[model samples]
Target: MIRRPVLLRAARPVALTLLVLFGTGTGTIDLWAQPVQKPLTKQAQTELDTIGAELRANARKREQKHQSARQIAEEMERLRTQMIDIARTQGASEKRAAIYRSRLETLTLLEADMTRRLGTLRNKQSRLLSALQIYSRNPPPTIFVSTRKANDAVIAAIILKEITPELKKRAAVLSEQNRDLIRVRREAALQNEALFISESDVSEQQKQLETLMADRAALEDQLLREADAIEARNLELEARQRTLLGLPSPLRAPQGRALDLQLPVVGEKAGSYGESIDGQTNRGLRLKTAPGAQVRSPGNGRVEYAGPLEGYGQVVILDVGGDYRIVMTGLGRVYVDPNRTVAKGEPLGRTPNLTDKPTIFYMELRKGENPVNPASGFDLTKL
Candidate 1:
C-alpha cells in the first residue's frame, strides 16, 4: 500500500452509478463543436511559464539518489497534482468524443448480450414444446371404455385434471418469454440505430476537434521557450533506435524520487502494471481507447522521441526528469516535435482507426535503465 499522496490526500470519495435502460426507439441530442479561441489572460500566461520552467529544470537534473517506496510515491504525487491543474478545460473536444464513444460501446455490448439471451430462450421453448408434444397429440382415453379398463380410464382422467393447472402455468411462462423475445428484438434495433448515429457524430467531431487542437497548440507555441539542443539529442536517439531496433537510454534527468503521467488518454481500464495476462507479465499500464481518441501528455516533460518505429506504431517518449522516461505506443499520429517542453494535458496525438478492436494505449515508466511498476509512483492507498 502507498502512503497518502498529494492528489489522493486532497481527493474525496466518489460513487458512480451506471444504468442501462433501453428504449423502444433511438433518441438524439443536437450537439455542436465550436471552440472559441480566447487569448490567455495575463495570470494564465504567468502560470504556463511557471509550469514550463519546472519541466525544463526537471529534464536537466543529473542527481542520482535512492529512496524508499514512501518517498517515491510522495514525490510523484506532488508533480501529478501540479500537471492536473494545468489541464483545466482545454480538453473540451476530446472529452466530448470520449463520452460519445463510451455510449456507442455500451450499446454494442448490450445488443450482443440481448441477442445471446434471445437465442437461449428460443432453444428452450423448442425443447419444451417437443417434450409436451405427445400429450398434445393424444387425448386421455375416453371414460366409455370396456368395463375391465374403465377404472384405468377414470384414473387417467383424474391425473389430467390434476396436471391441468401446471400445464397452464407453463403456458403462461412461455407467453412471457415470447414477449421477452420481442422486447429484445426492439432493443437490438434501437441500439443499432443509436450506434449508427453515434459513429457519424464521432467522425465529424474528430475532424473539428483536430482543427481546434492545432489552433490551441499554435497559440501556446509562441509563448513557450525554444529547445533546439533538446531536439538535436532526440534526433540522435531516434536514429539509434532505428539502427538497433531497441529503446534508447534515458537522457540525463528526473531529480525527483517518484514519477508518473496522469494518463495521456481517457480510456477503459485495461490492466495494472504487474498483472499477468494470457502468458506474459504486463510491464506497463494499458488503457483501451476508441478510434480517433486524442492522447495528451500526462505531466510536464520533454518529448525525447516521437513518430513510428518497426514493431510499434507512432510512439512518443518523454524525459520527465532524473533518469526517468515515459514511453507511449499505439498512437496513429504524433503532433508534437521531439525535445519540445510540454506542460501537462497537452495533446500529443490521435489513436489509429481500427475495425476489430479499440486502440490500446501502452504506457511504461523507466528509471535509468530498468522498467518499474508505474503504479508505484501514485499515492492511491488512501481513497
Candidate 2:
C-alpha cells in the first residue's frame, strides 16, 4: 500500500492565543514599532551605518545570484529545444557544433569566476572566525588602577580598553558578513555545477551524432528529457542547501502553526480591512512605505504564486500551512519564484520608488478561499 502525504492541520488554540495577545481596543495590531536604541557616539554610529550598508548589499547580491541562476537554466532549456529541432532537420551541422562549443566556453568562464569569488569569501570568513575566537579567549585587558597613581600610559591604556567593545562589535559584524557571503558562494557553486552538467550532456550528444550516427529523433528526445530531469534535480539540491542553511524547505514537515507573523515590510499603515476602495471592500491591510524598501516574507511558506496579477502590480502568495495563505501585492519586482520555499524574514522583493506617488503594499491572510483579518492571528505591534 502506498502511503499518502499528510496534510497540515491547524492549531486553533494557538491561533486564538495570538488573537488575545495582540488585540488592541481598536481591533488592529501595529507591527512597526521597535524598541529604542541607546544613543551611540558619532564613530560608533558611523560603524553601524557601514555595517547596515554591507548587509543591504549582500541581500542584493544574493537576489541577483538567484536571478542569474534562473536565467541560465532557462537558457539551457531553450538551447536544448533548439538542438532537438536542429537534429530533426539539419542532422548535426557544423554551425550546431560551433554553437554548442561557444556555450560550453561561456559556462566554463562563469564557473571560474564563481570559484574565485567563493575562495575569497572563504578566506575572509576564516580570518573573521579566527579574530572572534581570539577575542573570546582574551577579554580586553583592564587598565584602571588607583586614580591617584594614574599616569599617561594608564590613561592611554584606558582609552584603548574603551575601544575594545567597538572592536568586538566589528568582529561580530564581519562574522555575519562572512556567513552571507558563504551562502551566496554556495548558491553560485550550485549554479556552476548545473551549467557544467548541461555542457557535458550537450558535448556527449554532439559526439554521438558525429561518430555513432544515432537515430536523430530518438536521441534528441532522450537528451531533452535528461536535460529536464537534470534541471529539476538541480532545483531540489539548491532547495535542500537552503534548508540546511536555516531557510524554509517545502519538503520538510510543518512543525507548528505560525500564529505570530510579522509585517512583510516596515511602514506606516495606510488602509484597513473593510474599507471601501473603488466600490469594493478592502479585505487586507495596506501600508505606505518608502520607495525601494525591501519586502520580506512574514512567515515560513512555499510560494504558491509569484507574478503579476490583473489588479496588483506584482504579487506573492505564500501557503503558510493548514490551508492558511499570505498574499502580498504592489511590489516593484519579485525575487522569488513559484513553488520556492521561503523562510520568515527572507527578502521577497522591493517596493517601487515612485517620485510622484507613495509606494503602497497590500497584504492579506486567508484560510482556504476565505479572506481573514491579518491582525486576528498575527501580533504586528512589535518587530
Candidate 3:
C-alpha cells in the first residue's frame, strides 16, 4: 500500500503513534487514521519566541544609538560655537587664548578618535554582512542516496525511496530557511557591534563637549567679573572730569544756565526727580501720550549711539553741544544715523507700548560722559 506524503510531514509529532501502530499492525493503523493535533514542545516554542524578542531588542538598541549620535552631534555644534566665541573674545590674551586652544585641541582629538572608532565598526559590519551573504547563498551538504533491486520487498523499498526524495526536498527547504535565519542573526550581531562602538564614541564626544562648555562658562564668568569694576571706574573718571570742569557735584534744580531744549511732543508731564514710578526713581517726568508716540530731539546734536544700551532697548545717544548728551531709550526704531547732526525738535524715533498706559520715552542727560538726571537741568515745577 502507498503511504501519503502527509504521513511523513507529520513524522516527528506522530512518532509515538507510529511506533504503536507498527507494533499492532492493522488494528493500530485504523486508530492512526483519525486526525490528532500535537503542538510543538514548550522548549522549542520558547526558543523561537526568544529569537523574535532578541531581534526586537536589537532593533530598539539600534534606534537608540542613532538618536544618541544625533544628540552628540548637536552638543558638538554647541561646543563649536563656544569655541568660536572664546577664540574671538580671549584671543588677545595669551594665557586665556592658550586655554581655549587647549580645549579646541582636545575636542579635535576626540572628534578624530570617534571617526577612527566609527570607521573600524563600519569595516567590521561590512565583514559580517559579507560572511552572512556567503552563508545564506551557499547550500548545505546533500544526503547520500542508495540504489538497489526491486521485488516484493523492493516495491515497499521503492515506495519508501520515492517518499524519501520528498523528505529530502522538505529538509532542503528547512535548511535554506535555517541559513536565512543565520544571516539575520549575523546582521543583527553586526548592528549590535556598530551600535556599541558608536555609542562609546558618542559618550566620549559628550564628555569633551561638556568640558568645552565648562571652559566657555569660565571665560564668560571672568568677563562678567571684570565688567562691573571697569564700569565703576568709568563712572569715577566721569565724576572727576565733572569736578574739574567746575560743574556742581549734583546740578541743582533750575540752577544751570538755560538752554532751549525743545520738547518731543505735548504730552501730560506726569512725575519729577526723586519721585517713584514703576518701583523706580523717576529721573525724568513721565509723559503720558498715546501708544507709538513720536519723540523729537531736545536740541541739535550728532547721533553717537543708536542701538541697545543696557536696561534700555533701542536707544539713541546724541551729543548735544556744550558737553550735553541726550539719551532716549525704549525706542521702536531710530530715524537718525551715527554722527548725523539734527536741529532742535527733529524726530528721533517713536516709543510703542512702553508701559500699561500709553508709552513714554525714558530720557536722561549726560554732560560729556557724566549721566546727570534730566530733572536737575529742567524746571519740572513749571510742568
Give the per-residue lDDT digits (tens) of candidate 1, residues 1-383. 11111122112112100001121122220000111133344554454344334433433431111112223324334444544543443265346556655765775676577667657766875675565576557655656567757776567568767866876776687577667657656765665566566555545555555555555444323212122233334335334322232223433343343764566775665877788989788888777865545678878989999989889989899888878888899886688998899998887876653222466888888887677877655322211
Question: Whose TM-score is higher: candidate 2's or candidate 3's?
Answer: 2
Candidate 1 lDDT score at position 68: 24
Q: Name the better of 1 and 2 by lDDT.
A: 2
TM-score of each: 0.33, 0.35, 0.32
Candidate 3, residue 20: the lDDT equals: 28
Task: Count clashing pairs, candidate 3.
Answer: 0
Worst 10 residues of 1 by lDDT: 12-21
Compared with the true structure, model 2 gives a TM-score of 0.35
Root-mean-square deviation of every model: 27.2, 38.0, 43.7
On lDDT, the leading prediction is 2
Give the 10-residue window scoring lowest on summed lDDT in candidate 2: 1-10
Query: Which ranges of candidate 1 are over 4 A from the true structure?
Result: 1-257, 354-357, 378-383
| Deviation from native of the Cα of residue 151 in model 3, angstroms | 66
Which model, 2 or 3, shows the larger lDDT? 2
Q: Give candidate 2 regions above 4 Å deviation.
A: 1-258
Candidate 1 lDDT score relative to the true structure: 0.55
Residue-wise lDDT of candidate 2 within 1-383, one digit each (tens)? 00011011111222322423443244231210111123344554354344334434444453344344334434444555666764664434444545655665665666566666656766775675577567557654446545544564466558667866876676676566666656655665665565555556656776654443334323433433343344344345334323322334433322343565768876777777889888989999888865445688988889999989997889999998878999999987688999999999887976663332457888999989899987765664432
User: Which candidate gets the maximum TM-score versus the true structure?
Assistant: 2
